[model samples]
Target: MDRISDFILPAVIICIVGYGFIKKAPVFDLFLEGAKEGLCTSVQILPALVALMTAVGMIKASGALDSFTYALRPVAALLHLPQEVLPLALLRPISGSGALVIFQDILRQYGPDSLIGRIASVMQGSTETTFYTIAVYYGATKVQKTRHTLPAALTADLVGFLMSALAVRLLLP
Candidate 1:
């Protein structure tokens, strides 16, 4: 398996280059063009990434996140979910890196073998940064007026969070 994994990428590249040669395509030039386009796309998205990172930093520094988490503690308790995972659930849809920091903090606080840790792990796998994705992808494509997308993505994130809790409770020891 290890050998196959090592060989797979080179094999695929070889096949692609071979096919390009057969088709009389300028593989090197095409590769360079693609790389240049990717670099340009990265440059375009840098501002969005910086803005998100700054917002996340400001939110963390302002103690707003803690207040919000405290406010949600009652509802979380009622739902039989860990209060610790609340921030992760809320942030996961807004910023992937921000959610990751929360997720890592959870794992650090409660060892990965703990119930809360397992739930956090599952939640990370199950949920996604819906808003961040929309911002980046739609921003890149210059698509405005994201009507219904926000609601739908957020709904899915909520469901994923609930299912993550249910799954950990039912499946874990």
Candidate 2:
């Protein structure tokens, strides 16, 4: 234990000193600059957050989500997937709130202990917020075309969806 403590204490001290000396002034300034940018960024994104939430609310208010889920039933059946997971797949790549709603619906329909519910929960954890990704990328790059973006994004989204299901089945009881 004493040997372990001696080695660990010196290693920690060396790492701290190394980083402090190497980084120096730039690191502190960078951290402060990042914090300031993040603050301004939060304010800038407020409008976007409202718009996204309102749009998602309207979409959910409409009956479109039900039909969308229904349309995917055949595909899910063919894939031997649980019906409970269909809504999550459809919503996951579009909007975070929409995806959460679908995730909650899956939990409600399948129960938390069920395979589909576990898979949906895992899917939520593993994947990023897709709409947020596109928004950030487009916002930063100012690309307006939106051509080929959906398909490319969907490819990754689908993989995340399938991977979550497979992972839950393979890993969880």
Candidate 3:
């Protein structure tokens, strides 16, 4: 298993180069071109990434997450979900890093094996960073409008968040 893991990348590269040679393709040049395109895409997404990071930082610094968690206490209790996991559930769709901070905090405060910690972990894994994803993908592609994508992604994240909480409560002790 260790040997296979070590050799997997080289093996895949050799296979790809061999296939390219058989097909009379310019493998090295193609690889270089792909690298250039990837760099360009990274450059295009950089500003969006900076903006997102800045926004997340401000929200965190402003204590909005804490306030939001406080406000959601009623709903969380009604749903039989932990109020401590509310930050993770809310921030997971908007920003992964923000959600991770909350998730880690939960784990630190509650211990990984605790029920709230388990629920937070499950919520983090199941949800997607919807806005961050759209920002990066659309920014890289220069898409002018995202037409219904936000709603769909948010809906999926919401469903995933609810299901994750439900499953964790049902499955874990």
lDDT of each: 0.87, 0.77, 0.86
Rank list by TM-score:
3, 1, 2
Error at 166, model 1, angstroms: 0.5
Q: Write the per-residue lDDT of candidate 1 for residues 64-167, one digit (tens) a residue.
A: 87789899999999888898899998788877888898899999999898999999999999888886687677666666688898889888888899889999
Task: Write the candidate numbers in order of decreasing lDDT.
Answer: 1, 3, 2
Better of 1 and 3 by TM-score: 3
- Pairs that collide, model 1: none
Q: What lDDT tens digits, residue by residue, belong to model 2 across residues 95-154?
A: 787788778877897788888879888888888777777766555443669998878877
Best by lDDT: 1
* Cα RMSD to the true fold for all candidates: 3.0, 6.6, 2.9
Worst 10 residues of 3 by lDDT: 93-102
Total backbone collisions, model 1: 0
TM-score of each: 0.81, 0.69, 0.83
* Candidate 2: residue 167 Cα off by (Å): 3.5
Whichever of 1 and 2 has more TM-score, that candidate is 1
